[model samples]
Target: MDRVHLNPPPAADVAERADAHSVAPLLNCLLREAAAPHGGSRDADGRAPDDGRRVYRLRGSGRLLRVLGERRPAEPEMYVSDAWQRIGHAELVKLVADELRRHTGLSNHELPAEIIDSRNALAALLTARARATAPDDLYLRSEQSLLTGHPFHPAPKARGGGPVATWLPYAPEAHARFPLTLLGLREDTVVEEGDTSALDALGEAPPGYRLLPAHPWQLDLVGRELADAFADGRLVRLGTTGFDTWPTAAIRTLYAPERDLFVKFSLDVRITNDIRRLWRHDLLKLRRTDTATAAALAAIDGPAAWLGDRGYRTADFAFEELAVLVRDGLRGRVLPGATPLLAAGLVEGFEGSPLPGAQDPAAWWEAYLAQVVPPALAAFADHGVVLEAHLQNTLVAVGTDGMPVQALFRDAEGVKLLPDVSRAAGWERLVYCLVVNHLVEIAGALAAHHPTLNPWPAVRRELARHDLPEIPALLSSPTLPGKTNLLLRWTGADGADARYLPLPNPLAG
Candidate 1:
């Protein structure tokens, strides 16, 4: 609707905006994973459609579809009853299920509900945004500014189809901030790795216990499971934190600017592709992955930094359920006089976002490419560390003039160690996350705002400078792997298992 630069529109417009927001990503997934360009590739003008209105064949049903916009496609219509009829979120979900079932020879009873739930969630977020005051701090506003997340997922905002009142108070999109639920875990049952001393500063514990700060929403979701721990001596309820922590774009992660710390908590709710929980497998390997990523970012010669996971602490009885990861705050790593903003927010746009109105588009884009691309490439090439350099995992810090000065990457849970997987597999994963998922979205957003800018040439030049052998082949690959989230959900594949189909490589142009 807008550049994500303003609050939710007037009372009259929330549903329409919400519908548009919800429809864009669903259409994006269908077009990328299930639909093919129908008729001819070009419009009647005999040129590529700069306006994102294009028709597609639903591959499975061979039905014709039209949608507006490219980066975040919207305004879907199905050619039905001898006419193109516009469809709402519900109709779109039904059509998507039918097409996916026909194409994949599978059925997902749960996914359609998720698609609708995502739409409902957006309506709630938009309503909440209309009432709530956005944070004055640029970074906080950026962190809370994703109206539509995961530009190419079917149901990115679904929250287990839960009631809005239950989750809205904790949603990042609503500019939510609240005190953490403080609990004391008995010293005997406090399973911890690395230094989690930062948690101790948030609250106090009695003689026999260790302090643990938890997301209040997560506590609400798992109170029944944790009753035994609280009833017995294993866990004791201390009061809530005296200060509030703002939820970052990753809903479970809360940033306490007072202490300059971020604590990532476990949520059993499924958001996007996976249940956003601190599973035992990922938690156990957290240290090793965080270590490698930290070392790689340290060696990379630039302002680029890694927000390392300091450690984790939880009750041994409910380890995965209650675990909390303490992470390094931005005070130290972020360059002085620079404001760190979520890279995804840059694409989604915020009130003060520079991407939309960059005065020197070429210089702005080149500086962005220079800061973001080098560290990710270096991490893969020099250290065998493939950081999940996707948009959500990255933060680009800008100086006073709103020019990018540094890039910081996080989420060690998503990192892939090279030798653990084959070199080929590792490279593929790196390319998908870094190039397809991260840079392409950013470039699209930038180009949409500044049409004259050809974002890919700068990307190509940046890659050509990299020393890695894979860079040469990457530059010439005709297509890049575009993840098939829609098909993955329809086929009931493991959330961790990524399936890919090719999308034309923009850089190869």
Candidate 2:
């Protein structure tokens, strides 16, 4: 057999592929959150078009735009000179920047640049992915397969505007894996909370110091700032771990197969809506949030589980900067023989997704709803825990038949307590995260695969099984809160401060 040769595609081909991957998410944000429906374009019955292709008028520019494809917009065209002109990724960025400038009465120089960087990053990922061999484990393959992440963020692939060479070696998209950098912090400077026993097993530290593992990429970014501490012997480089860890979709989090543990680090990099560093405020409240979620999951009556963020370890001198979260891995929580795959990967698609090979699409979808919906709702109603059950945070385990048997949710940092936030606010957030962000994307992907199947009725039925007072309104509400990622970045809002615009609710019918 001949060996396969991996070579970079021509620059033009890279540009075209990058545009294909990046434009859809930006257009979805623009059309859903920014554009107004063209006048008199509603169907005869006054219903918005159900077809993926639709026409809209940009609210700011007042320009007509036509796009084909939904969930992930494609074939975007702008009406110019009384004719439709296809817009490339570069032109689309300009169009979006100009529209935002007019719509908000403000200009953002950084967002547009990030948009460019996002497209460039996608191009690099595509080139690297083509040459890379996917991991044999289906779960690992799914974890690393998100080429077009978020599907609604303008800059889903941006890496803090860094060069490709600087970040690609650790990129999950590139199927890269490397050992974690380890350090020995002086014992007096070690700060920790909860059970971080997993860290103790990574490597041994000297009598005067404790072991602290760090993401090498993060160390590279902040090394200069830490020269003083190292010089003073407060921090000692202990080299790297003996075993390698795979970076999950959330780039900062790595999965150590040997230990069956997840280590989340604080990296000063802007991924989608925020610089994804583990903030000091979040770290301070970590134990309380994780405890609430763990108890809620314990009360849940089924296999649906919560991967507890057991605890964290960091140096007191650089607490948030060097903090690392220790999370329970899949070995114990997941059912035996059932493989867990990232829910986002199921939507974005990968080499061996159960969605395409699903024998009974309707039954498969129902089984999925059964596994995913109840736990999230129960956590809210019975317990005050509001889970951020969006795609990336959720994992579905399927048995031999490829039918979903369990749902596991992670990320305590994103959870919200009921009494801390008003009931109404918590309900709205739960709805947005579980319904708009999670179920909608999965439903769309299922519908796309089996066009004849209608996914919302099953979802409505699954949600109706719950006794929450909000269910009736959720099913009948005319609109859902669609996150305004484009405007959020353009207006320089806090990433955690989510804003929304009304999007037509398919479940309303």
Candidate 3:
């Protein structure tokens, strides 16, 4: 697999802190500076500079933080900070409390303070939408995922407000202000990248301060109005949507900050177009699109309506950015008896290798194929939606006994349905994304999980057992499976070899 280099956070050195409380003064000073104008300036290279040297880069998030004073500024990169070395937990809490007070005028007790301290603090706070009452608006709901390991999800609000716009994290530098959303407060003030509505709301700066909001794209998702009514707080504000490129432009929350959910919203119009595209494939397209890859989820979502009724929770549909917000799953608090199958470590590993275990390769392989794959198929079958059951997209949580129990699928963009009931009708993209890109991951995982479960034979058997069309003939046919063999190159086997087999394309029927 190719390695993708992630841009690191701004540098902070551990040596500079007396305790976590030290971060408070730095945050206060930075927020104060962020609120002022001209207190900071762009360097010769158009970067924000401090004391004749570039202290930070102007990010899409609008606000700036100090890069390590030790590194040369011209490099234009994010590195670790020196202050973190000396900072203690007590001071960090104090700093966060002070900053929250400055922004929302509320204390730690009134808000989700513990969340504000987590790596995904900004995302969790923002994706939390105020609930709405109107039936039409109820289709939308705020979604959240973890940014890092921690317990935090914004407290559900009691009153109604507008839909949630976006939530993310924020930090500021001396004389420059950044939005609380950057720090992870739910914000609707800024509508686009580099927009500074949070600063505008703060009004005029005092003395040498300049205020800035986090970058617009940093936000997770725009909450449906229904969510606002349920969560009330002064910090949550509304912003204008000016983007005209697409009908109902929405923010899609992708994985970030080591933890976080990812979500994608489709415009009402776009959903219509997509549904049409999907229906063109086959009359059974819709049914195939909604079913789960693992038989386990199918059982739970199907005959197991009891699970959701009993305590196992499920949401109807997830918005893209909201997924990015709460992808961490209530700040890493997995409910009792429920396991998070798609954990950070598992996900990162699954991306490169399909197999689940580093040790006892043979046993791990059998366990993955037998235990993991069926639930996915079940989930999709029960839902009547062909889910993208691929490894990167699905999270199959197992119980203490190592048996699969729960299935969590992320990335709404990959979910598809038939026109009969889908908001997104005719959308082949969902089918391609979920069934093709996603389920392929499952196949890879099976291959990686065990050598005995050959990709070709396993795919064929699984497809046949699920009652999907075609098996032996497609493998012998010269065109389709042959193409896949060439494209995927199953473990270096020749496309024409007996080793290469085919699975029924539910869409083909």
Candidate 4:
């Protein structure tokens, strides 16, 4: 393991935090997807008794498990031999694997390793962070603030089990900023669409080649596969970019602050639910989906903005492997005098976070709902465009007072158009992404900080203002569709083909 340590924090401190980080999401998965609360029906509101430890029953094994904390479970203990035994990170992994094997009647050799890798990644990040200088920019700081990565992912920080040194230098959590490896693709073999004019400014290309900026990590992963292209002069290395680009929360997407542009590249590494690659199939239809989302958002009232996937650049032979997608930067997208922060980052707080110090949590919650809810609802109701407005996909810009003033949505590849999928199916996906994944997590974070604030009514009020037909049932429904990442991975389900189970709808008061 490669670690940077100057005035290093105690090794025990790093290990402890890593253990807690690893356990929380895994426990979240077990609680949501594979287990039932001890005694009667699973608690919808997650109300535990005075000690702050909650008991659960692993349905497959009938094992009684208890853990401390609600949002991020820690100090896990399991009932054994008529006694409770505390389990460490290693034991917890083994326990989870055994339970999943029994529960799904399936063995997953890969996910366990990925989960371990995620922990290892965290340890490395913690070590680097102690010595690394955090960025001064509030927005960039927020983007890189997700040290724990996806709150619900079993192995959110797994970097394809690659060498830690190889990926750590590019990790957002480490405040990494590096120059891109510039490649010049032969003009005749260059494949692209939409406005990629921003790419040319990154670096210069020779007479017959187009400027193609490749993520160095991606190149390292696939260089052997493209030996023919390089040897035959179809792809030429033209050195590196003169300036540095910071890796955002999405490790594959690098934001060049100097250019005020975002360039997403194909890293053959899995980040979160999918391999962080700009797939050709998605790229082929990028314009159509992005155009629809852009048009729908523009037509909606208020300050919602869509950061369209302007275009992609790739080689015909190594299209998917060498691809890069360009997206709109914050220059003109956000409202004037506002700082756009990653909405997901709000849940996973940083030093300058407004949520913790908010003077009026109720007012803040109302403003948050106002910025985030309308666009997704309007897009679905008016234009039949379902925006994947999950926490990671959305950006909330806050005014100087730290009140949210605007919402910006991105990732056209995740967008689904109407009639392409039935209205019912589209609505379910919208509800799951926008309400379940996005709002529920943020609300929990907000309420955790401000115990007196009940964030749901404001959410309900904001949502009810929308005229979507599904709003009535959605408000009254007892459960919302929650994507089962844990079971899906265990059962070898396709990543894109989501399978969901019922989660208590916080909106249904």
For candidate 3, what is the total of clashing residue pairs?
140
Off by over 4 Å in 4: 1-5, 40-50
Candidates in order: C-alpha RMSD to true structure: 2.7, 2.6, 21.9, 2.8
| Candidate 4 lDDT tens digits, 468-490 | 78999999999999999988777
TM-score of 3: 0.33
lDDT of every model, 2 decimals: 0.88, 0.90, 0.30, 0.89
TM-score of each: 0.96, 0.97, 0.33, 0.97
Candidate 2: which pairs clash?
Answer: none
Best first by lDDT, ranked: 2, 4, 1, 3
Among all windows of 10 consecutive residues in model 3, the one with the lowest summed lDDT is 305-314
In the range 469-499, model 2's lDDT, one tens digit per residue, is 9999989999999889999999999999998
> Which tens-of-lDDT digit does each residue in 347-442 have in candidate 1?
899899989778898899889989999998898888899888999999999988889999999999999998987788888998999899999989
**Could you give candidate 3's per-residue lDDT for residues 72-165 as a string of tens digits?**
1111222234221222434434433454455434444522232223222222232221111111110011112211111111211101122222
- What's each prediction's clash count? 0, 0, 140, 0
Between candidates 2 and 3, name the one with more favorable lDDT: 2
Model 2 / residue 267 / CA error / Å: 0.7
Alpha-carbon shift of residue 324 in model 2 (angstroms): 0.5
When summed lDDT is taken over every stretch of 10 residues in candidate 4, the lowest stretch is 40-49
Model 3 alpha-carbon miss at residue 150, Å: 27
